[model samples]
Target: MNKLMILTGEPLTRSILANFFDGISDFCVEGSFEDVPGLLSAVQNSQVDVLFADAEYAMQGNFLPLINPYGAKRPLIVLLARDGQAAAKSYEMQNVIDYVIKPSTPERLFLSLQKIRMQLSLINSYEAVGAPHSPRRDYVFIKVNKKMVKLSLDEILYVESVKDYIKIVTEKKSFLVYNTLTNFTASLPEGRFARIHRSYTVSVDKIDAIEGNTVEIMTTRLPFSRKYIAENQLKVFK
Candidate 1:
């Protein structure tokens, strides 16, 4: 199980977050605090996988390097901020998974944890697979607009199925092809792409974020049909 921690100043906020984590099957709340005393020390000492904290409180406590200064597996952070502006400042911090606006609901917290669990699993898989520059299968050619296009496999970020069409997204551009997501995933090299969701076959190396059923690659965030959530069989998250 992934160990979780919450650092917020409001007593009610702490209670709400801690209580919300009770039903998660993959996460366990180790503690909740209203202050930042020994916060960094606690995270490094304990085997914490994820931390949820208020942005204002964290800044007040001088927790600037809270992104794993001790470098012990680098626990993920989910900042709870007063607004979007406060959340923007977190872009400078590494290991931050996501952020939530204050007065967020219990359901919101639950959803964020679910997304975090998936992300952490994917990160582990990436490490196991080695660095992005490591050797990979040769590029494949595909026909688009009645023209043959030579595409590097490493450049392909993810493929999305929209209605009857499949969209192949790369770092530079996106291509629309009349193909099924199933067919595209099958044509790829074995274990090269992971079906994060039914409609999205993501190049594991290109994943920027995983939030709910939406997977972000580069600046594009694509939502997979949530109807297939029950059918999801992602081994990485298992």
Candidate 2:
């Protein structure tokens, strides 16, 4: 049975969640709380499989900071209100597993829960079958001016060499890290990400258009070096 933890300020919402899962034999409501501090403590101590937290709770100064800690893994669910775009943005920056907008029906909630269970089951099956667990390409921790940050792989658009440093460009922002382009290239997964230039490594999916030796990514024109031009040409041909 999967243990679920609910952290919502509304009493009616809490009751509804409990009742919704009451008949599910494989799900157990381990804890439900209106207190954010108390809920955080409980989550840290308990073997929680999923968390359903209200977005309004964060507006009132109750925040879930652990979901995207340094190099920590993301939690299962983060339930937010449809009107709470600010809270949703915060959760997205942290790279939470999934976020659902309320007032969600029991059917929607059930489907989300089922998806989590299916994913977990698949992971377990892979382990049992002796399938090697390759390290996640997106799971990289970066230190910036004494603060550590975790960046999602999908968020990265491209990386460019700037002398001794590498500039990481994302959809929303960019950051300069004290590392060479080669070092950063090694961290990316093969095939999906490729070094097209001496200074540039771009996500293949982020390519807007390819013109001659330059690949267009959004507004930027990234040049492909002689070594990678042939390979990328073959890709374009296919």
Candidate 3:
């Protein structure tokens, strides 16, 4: 289980977060603080894997200056703010994983927890192997219905983004995954996929034709955004 800490200046907010995490099996709340010094001290004394902090306090206060001195020992941060105003600035910190808006719900927090798990998994894998693991096989494991589903890379034709989810299209059917287009694309083999639009990513080798702004895969033609024209170096565009 990953140890988590909550650092917000409001006692009510801290209590709510701590109580919400009580039932979660994968994470344990080490402590919750209404001040930076208390949080910093706890961080120094405990083994914390994740820290959910108020975004304003993290950015505008003396919190970062004191905490950053810990360097590699600093726990991963998830900033909580009323709006996205502090998101860009807070993300500059390497340890920050997610920035959530206030009045956080279980669903939103679940997504943030998923990101934290993925980051921790990557870090652990790299530390154990001394390098990033490259895919040796053509298949990748995707989470579906609370289980891991092994999917072949070649089985993917294209991916469509729908709001907070992505649809992975294959020959027979498509799977709806609770993931952003950006995160889903990063999980796939890098060179094999081309992001042709903000909402669409296609398999490079599966391209049947490209006429104007449309890319044809099998009998289906998908529109490509001109914004990616310069970024696309596929000879098919020639």
Q: Write the per-residue lDDT of candidate 1 for residues 107-204, one digit (tens) a residue.
A: 78778877687878865775677457556645654546533366788999888888756788887889886445766576677656777666788886
**TM-score: model 1 vs. ground truth:** 0.50
Segments of candidate 3 deviating more than 4 angstroms: 68-70, 131-238
- In candidate 3, position 199 carries an lDDT of 94
My TM-score estimates for the predictions, one after another, are: 0.50, 0.49, 0.51
Quality of model 2 by C-alpha lDDT: 0.68
Question: What does each candidate score in C-alpha RMSD?
Answer: 17.3, 12.3, 10.4
Sort the predicted structures by lDDT, highest score first.
3, 1, 2
lDDT (Cα, tens digit) per residue for candidate 2, span 15-104? 878888888888899899987877877777776666777766644432544422322323455565666565554343222344566676
Writing each residue's lDDT as its tens digit, candidate 3 over 120-234 gives 8876764567434653546655545534466898999999998756788999999876456766676666678889999999989899988989999999999888988778766
Judge candidate 1 against the unseen true structure and give its global Cα lDDT, from 0 to 1: 0.69
Return whichever of 2 and 3 wins on TM-score: 3
Model 1 CA lDDT for position 72: 26
Candidate 3 versus truth, CA RMSD in Å, comes to: 10.4
Q: What lDDT is reached at residue 56 by model 3? A: 78
